[model samples]
Target: MRVINFAHGDMMVWGMYLAWLLATRLGIDPYLGFVGCAAALFVVGLVVQRGLVDRIVDAPHEMQILLMLGVALVLENGALLAFGPEPQRVRSALTLSTFWLGPLFVDVARLVTFAVAVALSLALYLFLFGTDLGRTIRAAADNAYGALVIGADVRRVYAVAFGIGAACVGAAGALVSPFLPFQPSAGLAASVTSFNIVIIGGMGSLLGAFVGGLLVSVAESLGAVFLAPSLKELVSFSLLILILLFRPAGLFGRRAG
Candidate 1:
């Protein structure tokens, strides 16, 4: 995923933040917040893809980056205007009540988060691999020109894929909303996390994204437990550097986009 998708870290953090905020402030459950946010994000993604990214599907990669940057700016500023500049948090009932499992401390929230992430990943895989529309999406992703020649609705596919990706971030936000502090600018960190996962896992591969998330989460957990809890970012980036040095193609992939 890392080899293909750029900036996954950002996505994870942003989504998680949204989930955290919605649940804590509105008296809703985290999972409920996740569902609502994902749904909302799906709509937002549809609009962004249909209204913006769709227009530049044929644009050069560098141009696409520029376009995304512009959109990021708008979203960030919009958050600033609407949510203000302070860090915000939602109430999640999860606590440090850990179970001593024969020498390791396990937090229930972490376990739950992992479980939820896995379930969501499975759903994403099914959506991508289980139906006719999924095949068209894959085809369009592979080659827009060929897809267009074959009568594939490339634009529609683009919209759906982008929508799915954005909605994933939203679900992420709503899931861990109860456990952290967030601000509009938190998206920057989320972007960084997603970018790391994508690079470490491989690009354009959902399986890569899933593994990247697990690997990075494990690494982060280990770092927090053994090293300075403050060194989470430092540790994560160090692992990323090692992975890139030894297997530049990514943990589960070869080839790049």
Candidate 2:
């Protein structure tokens, strides 16, 4: 989508906080809380889209960027007020469980997270390629005016896209919460990481994103082990710069006609 969502990272933090609350207060499993968090984030995305984004869909790009930035600020500050400044860690049964496969030991939480991520990605691909609503969304993304001319409800599709995007963040938060610590402003780093991934993989290319993330992860891991841990990000960015210099459209991005 052409939409700019600066608050996306904050939304992930919000979802993490929700899952944390459930885990700590209600003794709900983190995996189970994912369901509620995803649903809530979907509603949040729709409300933000319809209430704020829709109002400025046709506005200048600068205006849209500024608006989203403002939303990001509000969300970050609101989280600070609501959740306080403390860092939270969510512990699940899966956190420490691991299995040995030959000489390789696999973390249960990481493996399950990977499985869930793969499943979601496959489902999203199917939705985009195999369903009418998904096609409508693609149409709107490719040509909003043309989609409107074809009687496609562009705004509705946009809302759905936005909601799905938010829901993804929620799912990611739930998956990572098992091992990652959560803070009110952790979204800042997440947002940066997401931007890097999108740029490296080619914006709008699902397969590219998956591959790019793997590449980045490998680079980071190697850099951390071989070089100073603090230089991992530097290594990744250096690689990104090299890639951009050669492939300006990104590894998987095709030039739009």
Candidate 3:
């Protein structure tokens, strides 16, 4: 669970493509098709974790980095071959809808996205805290050897955890498909943004990651408003630098011993 998933963004790209496929072929909207995408990516995560990551669980950090990087490259290239290089966006009726609340006009698609994201986050929180499997996962994360000694299937737990993480990514990809024009090459930027959020929030801290995402999003939006839209990323990176300088452990992250 502590493993750095460098392939995450590429995996999300696959989710996007899967949603696109469903939308075009079956006439399923991305919003509705996201469930299938999540389920598919869950399997992908399980296979990757069980077949590849398990073997290198105890390897050096560099090895883990290289392994995921390799996986990312493979996924990216695979998407390129399958989907070609052109950017794709999923079509949905909600994309054309908007509502005015108070003095603000909000896109319906984005509103739905925000609502679903919150629901997913809440569901994840409940899953991790209120369920037996969730407790076991937390235990395994805290002390794998202890969990193993207690007869818990640590490997399976890890696999499931990875699967759930991947599923979340897939759902996210599908949710954004209506608005974000994506191609295989887009994975790099997505990965970079993800890394920025994680680092800014603090590694191994879920709350940090959540808050970090909000902060980063707000920063980017503000950047787009005040600066050149193309320079929004520059604002994100600048915030990352400031966070790294002032709170390397992240605002909510605990200092490592």
Candidate 4:
């Protein structure tokens, strides 16, 4: 999407916090909180898009980035105020479980999270390529003015795109809640990594993002095990720098004509 949502990481944290609230207070399983988390984030995305994002859609990129950065600060600080600075954990049966595949062992929670991520990604791809709403969103993203000229509801498309993106963040939060600690700034930890993946894979290309993520994951794991653990992030960051210098449009991204 062309919409620059710098607050996306914070939105993910909000989803994690909401799921934690449900799990801790309502006795609901964190795994089962995926639905609620996604729904809440979808609504939040809608409100944020309508109230803030829509106004900046046609503005300069710098203005849009600053606005979203402001939104991110508000979200982060609001989380700190409401939940305090303490880190929280969501308890689940799969938290400590493991599965073995011959000589390999995997954390069950992490495995499930991976599976859910793939499934959701596939679902999103299908929706984007197979549904009318998806086509509308694509049209708007490709050419907002042309979309308007064609009588498409550009604003509505933008709103829906934001909602879907927020829902994706919520789903990711839900998937990782069992293993990752939830805090006001926990999601921020992944912010830089997310940017690297998008840039490496090619912005606006789902398959590129997926492949870039996998490459980063493998690089991090290999670096952690073979090199100093402290150097894992450095490896990925180096990869990002290489990508930027050599393939500015990304491995899969096409250069604009």
**What C-alpha lDDT do the candidate models reach, one value each?**
0.72, 0.86, 0.92, 0.85
Q: What is the C-alpha RMSD of each candidate to the true structure, in Å?
A: 2.9, 1.5, 1.2, 1.4
- Give per-model TM-scores: 0.86, 0.95, 0.97, 0.95
Q: For model 1, where is the 10-residue window of minimal lDDT?
A: 1-10
lDDT of 1 by residue, 158-196 (tens): 788877887887787766665666777777677778779
In order of TM-score, best first, we have: 3, 4, 2, 1
Best by lDDT: 3
Better of 3 and 4 by TM-score: 3
Query: Clashing residue pairs, candidate 3?
Result: none
Model 2 clashing residue pairs (backbone): none
- Model 4, clash count? 0
Q: Compare candidates 1 and 2 on TM-score and give the better one.
A: 2
User: Positional deviation of 180 in candidate 2, in angstroms?
Assistant: 0.5
TM-score of model 3 vs. true structure: 0.97
Better of 3 and 4 by lDDT: 3
CA lDDT, candidate 1, residue 252: 79
Off by over 4 Å in 2: none
Candidates 1 and 4 compared: the better one by lDDT is 4
Residue-level lDDT tens digits of model 3 in 33-145: 99999999999999999999999999988888999999999999999999999999999989899989999999999999889988998898899989999889988987899
